[model samples]
Target chain A: MSFLAAASTNINPGLKAMGYGLSAIGPGIGVGIVFGQGVNAIARQPELTSTIRTNMLLGFAFSEALALIGLVAPFIYTS
Target chain B: MSFLAAASTNINPGLKAMGYGLSAIGPGIGVGIVFGQGVNAIARQPELTSTIRTNMLLGFAFSEALALIGLVAPFIYTS
Candidate 1:
């Protein structure tokens, strides 16, 4: 009985950590895609460099925020 | 016994996902800085814009690939 209780306690944290990890996947891919597209756009049109860069930064910020949200989710749910 | 096992299995995926998510941070910041610097460089010297832009995109792609690797990490670890 004691062993089972100890095991459960250990497993709970592990599962929670896993959930947090999985949540980051979308943001990770999202940031990469956004940056890749941004780079390509700039490469194609040097004249609109400033405009493109502003938009790219904005997109990057949002995507990074997604990853941050994922990191926080486990604590939010578990607590 | 069965419940504990099931819980651990469930948690494993979430942790893997979190690991993937955390992995994106460096690349995200790196791409942002690269683009920002690229833009500034172009703004300062319009004539060198073409060269600067090309180098910027190359840097961006390399940073982006880091995130791509993060996305693929889980499958690599689990398998």
Candidate 2:
């Protein structure tokens, strides 16, 4: 039990950064999909390009904000 | 050996929450993109607006739920 405890006790400061890094993967894919699909839609219908573009930006903003919050969470909770 | 062991014992609970927070970032961005582009698609193809809108809502809800899951992970795991 002592051996197990000691093994588990080893701290890794990088673990937090690693977690944050892993979290970024999904958002990256999501953002890519949003824009990729939006562009395809716009290409097919140029008339509504502005509207599409506007909504795309808004979506990107909200999602991106969540990521930003995640980035800050460590610091926020620490305080 | 003792010095190394001594350095290893410190653990931060924040590390886990930081992990959960990190997990949220991707889904957040994902939901944003899904909805944003869906709106754009709807604006362009007004006829298919309902279909696109529904799908977007579904996607957003799913991704948002994932983010919520991440939000709760630390509480569940640490306990």
Candidate 3:
């Protein structure tokens, strides 16, 4: 029982990292989609490339923010 | 027996945060797809930009709802 108690504290040092990893999963795919589609959009309408690229970047920023937050959220919850 | 209970109490404080991380994943990708395809649609049919944007936003909201739900879900489970 004492050993169990000792082990409990040490059991999940990597848990925070794992949380960040899981959190990043969504954003990673999301960024890929935004850029992939953005490229396709540009190919379809080269004249609107500027507008399309701007929108794509905006979407990228929003999606990437989630991953960044995930990186920070662990510290927030732990503390 | 008391020590076992004590150990259990101290375990996995970060579990809730991990729950949130897992939950965010699907919505993240979903949102990306919605916006990406929306942008592509707009480029393909520039005249329909307004309609495309409206639909894109609706899709984004629905997908974002899932992640927001995930953020709140851990508390629901814990309490």
Candidate 4:
């Protein structure tokens, strides 16, 4: 039991950054999808490229907001 | 053993934010998927732009709601 306790003790509890990292993953993927699909749409209809780009930027902003929120959540929830 | 205990005591048990972070991921990706597809659909049929945009916004709201819930979850689950 002492050995187990000693091993566990070595683990750090500064996992707030880990939480931010985890939250960033989803938004990262989300932003990627928005741009990827936007590019595909532009390619299919070059005339609509501007419109597709506008939509992609809007989507990126919305999705990226979540990751930013994650960054702030730890500070907000001190418990 | 005393040294080990002392070291462990310095570590925090604040993993609530981590749970919220994990929960945000799915919805973030969901919102991305909705917008990505919506843009692609609009490219295919520009005439349906309004309809697609409406659907996309609605879907985004639904998906984003999940992330918002995650933000509040840490407070609700204090254990």
Candidate 5:
């Protein structure tokens, strides 16, 4: 692990970026599942499609926000 | 944000931890939606409650696993 550290007693830029990259993966899959299931719910109830669609968008936005945050995290904390 | 740190730093642990923290948010909400909507599905059709409940648990488990991976990421790439 130290081999990747690159500098003694200091932080690493590449490692920080890699961390953000790792972070995006979970939220990416998570958003997919949320929307996919929401759509399935709507499909099962066409009459309730509007309600389901509203909630689906809400869930999707929330899930996507996490990924967006991950995208920005490295810039926020890296020094 | 860079103003919070001194000049010429090699890397930042804060960035990596923040990255992982951001990653967990999506899956957290995702699992919540999976079960929440699943419960609604069961309510709509009581006869299928058992089947819906089983699938709900399975989806929740998978979403939780993603958050778990994000939780471990900072430790993995901290080098």
Candidate 6:
């Protein structure tokens, strides 16, 4: 019983870390979609490239923030 | 001691959720900025509107992904 309990306890942190890693998946996919679309738009309208680029960067920044949260979650929870 | 420990553990989830929620703010603002600039670009150069719109949408999707990640973070952590 004691050994089982110890093993489970050790597994818990790994599970939690895996969760955090998995949580990042959504943001990763989303950001890619956003950029892909942004590029498509720019390609269609070369004249407005500057504006498109600016917006794309801004959106990219935001999407990246979510991953940052995922990275921080485990520390916050365990602490 | 047990009560304090339980209370802290209970509070931990909330904190994690809040962190996730806070993480979304960046993406929200980022997407808005992206759309705003995209619109402005389209307005300035009507001929390239189609291209600009497409790019904008793509960027928007990516930015929104971040929020999705935030939404999933809590569930992943707790599970």
Best by lDDT: 4
Residue A64 C-alpha lDDT in model 2: 65
DockQ of 5: 0.16
Q: DockQ for candidate 1, please give it.
A: 0.10
For candidate 4, write residues B1-79 as lDDT tens digits.
3433423432232476677689879877888899899899999999999999998999999999999988887677644
| Per-residue lDDT of model 1, residues B1-79, tens digit only | 3433323334555565555556666666666667656655655566786788689778877876776676666666644
Across residues B1-79, which tens digit of lDDT does each residue of candidate 6 receive? 1222221133455555555556566566656666766676666667776766776776677667666665665565543
Docking class of 4: acceptable
What residue runs in model 1 are displaced by over 4 Å at the alpha carbon? A1-79, B1-9
lDDT of 1: 0.61
- Candidate 6 has an lDDT of 0.60
For residues A1-79, write the lDDT of model 2, one tens digit per residue: 1333344544445655665665666667667777877788787778888877776775676566556656655553331
The lowest-lDDT stretch of 10 consecutive residues in candidate 5 chain A is A1-10
Tens digit of per-residue lDDT, candidate 4, span A1-79: 2433443342234677888888999999999999999899999999998899889998999999999998887777654
**Candidate 3 CAPRI assessment class:** acceptable
TM-score of 4: 0.83
List runs of model 4 lying over 4 Å from the truth: A1-13, B1-13
Per-residue lDDT of candidate 3, residues A1-79 (tens digit)? 3534433445444777787789889989999999999999999999998878877886787777777877776665642
Q: Candidate 1 at residue B71, lDDT?
A: 60
* Tens digit per residue, CA lDDT, model 1, A1-79: 1334333334646665665565456556655666676676677667776766775675577557646655665454321
lDDT of 5 at B13: 61
Query: After superposing candidate 5, which stretches have Cα over 4 Å from the reference?
Result: A1-11, B1-9, B14-79
Deviation in Å, model 5, residue A29 alpha carbon: 1.4
Clashing pairs in 5: A11-B10, A11-B11, A12-B11
